[model samples]
Target: MCGRFSLYSSYSTLSQGLKLPLEVAVKLTPRYNVAPGTWITAVRHPTDNEPLVMDEVWWGYRPHWAKEKAPEPINATVEKVATSNYFRGAFAHHRCLVPADGWYEWLPLNGKKQPHFLCREDREPIWLAAIWTERPDGKPGCAILTEPARGVAKEIHPRMPLALDAESLKPWLDPHLTDRETIRQVVHHLDAELITHWPVSTRVNRPTNDEASLIEPLKP
Candidate 1:
């Protein structure tokens, strides 16, 4: 599952990369260590709403039904999310695009963990297909939808974010289309599309190292 990610590319770049209909309003700055519980931008197209809007949502979910003992699930299993109590409604009404320039995954090596950054070789933005739910107080919470890893990412982690390509992004973002089976078909299998990875300095492992240098390819 995607616990942390990076989308430090400028918003203009992302707006163009995602083919956003309107210019993004917020100033875009580089953020290397994007953690959960903070406001992150996501694109959503609710059927009754206007064109796709950039929304800021917390990247973690606390189900209205969660018990104190139930650890908040950052990722709702796609295998059961449609029928599950915690995810069913959001699966229908809260689908969104969690954009990222790339994401971080770790590979265990000789007594150490080496972190790898995966992104499009073209350096374009990636849209992570996600499902979000709203809190009673109107605050929104989200989770990065995950599936089996593929491409160069499999070697690093067994599961990775459901990074939707351009073609599949439409259905993923449209809230009017809520056929569970269709959504399942869209998200079920991993796409073997353009994905590239590079080794980076482990400085990304820290919560404080939030800068572009964290993603720079490291020299041995």
Candidate 2:
């Protein structure tokens, strides 16, 4: 599961990488350590075919039917999202792209876990597939979809956030495309070869450590 990640890259970098203009009115700053429950940037297509818009949404996903106090799920598996009680509706109609510069995963070494940062070798932002819903209060919440790990990702954890390739971004975020089968085909599993990872300081374990240094590779 992707409990934490970062988007420290600049707005121009993200814009060029994702190939979309920012639609959110607020200026986005570098975020070195992002945690769940906090507002994060999500890119989605608007109903009227306007430019893609960036919206701030809580990282955890809470479906409309869930009770007000129920725990929101942070990760929804792509395989089960089609029929899952909590994600089926969102998956079919409200898919989104959660942008990240890199994500942290803890790998067990001896008895302790060491944190590692994974991102594209080209240094471009990786787009994570997600689903979102609005609360009764009108606040939006979203969940990152996870899939079985492959290549280098398997070394850190058994599951990794489902990242999409450049070609798959459009269809995945299309507001008008609601066919389950078509949506399923749009999810492009990230190629492990496109990613690179290295051990990082454990300071990332604390959500309070948001400095850029937290992502600097630790001495091997």
Candidate 3:
């Protein structure tokens, strides 16, 4: 349900926050229409001893088994990803983190969807639980996983992005720890209290608008 999100932080801020190695980065200007198919940054922890690393990847999933031409599925369901063949392979090999300042969901209105902006009161960036893929000849791609919405997210969307913290994220990314019990503990439990929501102007509905006013609170 996290169709759109924002990353207003600078490259160094993100690098420091995620503890990543420096690499050539595609300029990350402020965005308000970060939809599917675009390149995005994800952080990963390869080993317990190594530092977390952030790198850019596409924001969609194209399973190796899919015969269709479409190569990027924007969303993945956490409940079925572990068991589904289309996702199980990537689940084991391509775990990642989708960092964001916040996310956007929409409320159904008179034949239109009105957007709402959600953020942590801390005003800090959050890391979404994500899965990814790497093609032999293409840019690495990823998908944001979803779980049943709770807290403020429930008011706008039935399902919300699966978000994780340092503790839970470690287990989720460790390929060798792929067991039912471990995945169960990380996937089933979540932290929703870290979020707050506000109604925003309908300008966010348009994919072309990338202004700050899109997240501004609507006056009564």
Candidate 4:
């Protein structure tokens, strides 16, 4: 369900990879163990006719109109996001891209769960499709979209974050492209063949264990 992920790429690298303008002033600290409910980087068109901007957004979604007690979900399933009453508004109008190095999934092995890191085979940054909205507190909150896992990711878990192909990023973030069917036609997920996964230290299970070693392959 993409509950944990990593985004340690430098600003320059993310800028080049995501085609972000140099003037978008935002500072980024490398995070190897990003968890739900924390602020995370996302690229979006904040308003009509506005250029795309990269900024931090709380990694949980609760539409401003929802009751204060409404659940703030971190991941929204693609199957229902387009029609769900709680998510359709943001899905149609507040699409964003979450840049990450990779995401973590746990597999039940023996009597315990083993954590695995899933990433692009080329080691390039991945842009996860997401939607955001203004929360009651006036802060932007977002939820990463998830779909049925494909290829190697299916082996790790039944679902995975919807990582977009490079060609789909701009269209996915286009504020004017709000029609659900057209969005489905113009946007597509990254090819499953490009994804790879490997077992990693369980240290990632604890959100505070942020470090380079957390992503390194665990020794056999």
Candidate 5:
């Protein structure tokens, strides 16, 4: 499930591709390996007529109803998101886009898993479907939604982040639309042909290694 990913594209490129404003894009830096718990930029359409805003929030979610000591969750299964008490509120209202150039998955091999980098063949950044909420202290946090993997993603893992295309983005982020069935269908039906992936160096297993080489195809 998109536990690790990359966003090495320059702010200008990401801004242009994602349609984020220059003011917001300028604040982001090149991140080759992004992990949970770190602050991440997310795009939200607050209103139908309003321009999308880019805001930074914690990558993990800590529901307001949970105890302060509860462990934050980085991923939420799409099937349960609409009905889950901890996420229903956010699912109905706080939908967002977690933009990334690509994502990483692992193939279980021996006792270790081999890492792979997956991205769109067109080279466009992808918007991962997500839900966000505010902590009791007013801190904003988000969780990526995962679904049963299909296409290339299924080869490596059984789950992958719920990815949305241009056509699906409008409905998924429509703040006024709160119907669970509509949201589920809009996000679940994605075109698998647009994706491609390759095995990468295992260096990515370490969160500390944030370099371009980490995504390079592993040598035989």
Candidate 6:
């Protein structure tokens, strides 16, 4: 599960990488420790013919029609998202992308959990596949999609965020591509071989401890 991540890349870098004209309305900041239930940047296709739009959305999902007491999950498993009653609607119609510099996953070590930062070896931004919907309060909320971890990520945890390949970003966000099978065929995750990880300071365990040092490799 991608419970914590970082997104300190500049708006210009993200714009050039994702090839979308990100709206400057939402001020960009260097977030080295991003937690759930807070506003995060996402790219979405609001309508069938509209260009993709980048905006801030709550990092938790609860459909507007769901009961007020329904659970707002931050991550949705790819295995069931396509058919789960609570997520299928958004999965089919509201797919989006969550950009991140990297994500943190904890590994159990000597009865303690050691946090590790995972990212592409090239140091480029990763685009996590996600789905969103308007919450009862009229704010857009999203849940990042997760799948079985592969390569180095599997060594730290059994699952990881579903980061998409550059070629799949536009198709994944296409509002008209609602068929589950077709989506499965056209979209694909980034190559696991491109991912690399390193143990980081436990300071990241606290959401408030946000800074550049949080991502520094923990000294041996």
TM-score of each: 0.89, 0.93, 0.84, 0.97, 0.90, 0.97
The lDDT of each candidate is: 0.78, 0.85, 0.74, 0.93, 0.82, 0.92
Q: Which stretches of candidate 5 lie over 4 Å from their true place?
A: 19-26, 45-51, 185-189
Summarize candidate 5's per-residue lDDT along 89-203 as a digit string, tens digits. Answer: 9999888888888899999989988899998888788889998888766777899999999898889999998888677877777788899887767654457888889999888
The local lDDT score (0 to 100) that residue 99 gets in candidate 4 is: 94
Q: How should the candidates be ordered by lDDT, best one leading?
A: 4, 6, 2, 5, 1, 3
Give, for candidate 2, the lowest lDDT window spanning 10 residues.
Answer: 44-53
Model 1 lDDT, full chain set: 0.78
Regarding TM-score, does 4 or 5 come out ahead? Answer: 4
Please give the ranking of all candidate structures by TM-score, highest first, separated by commas.
4, 6, 2, 5, 1, 3
Residue-level lDDT for 136 in candidate 3:
36
User: lDDT per residue, candidate 6, 119-218, as tens digits?
Assistant: 9999999999999998999989999999999999999999999999988988898888899999999999999999999999999999999999998899
Q: Which stretches of candidate 6 lie over 4 Å from their true place?
A: 21-24
Q: Tens-digit lDDT track for model 4 on 120-217?
A: 99989999999999999989999999999999999999999999998898889988898999999999999999999999999999998999999999
Q: Give the TM-score (vs. native) of candidate 3.
A: 0.84
Residue 145 C-alpha lDDT in model 2: 92
Say which prediction, candidate 3 or candidate 4, comes out ahead on lDDT.
4
In model 2, what lDDT does residue 18 have?
75
Off by over 4 Å in 1: 20-25, 45-47, 65-70, 185-193
TM-score of structure candidate 5: 0.90
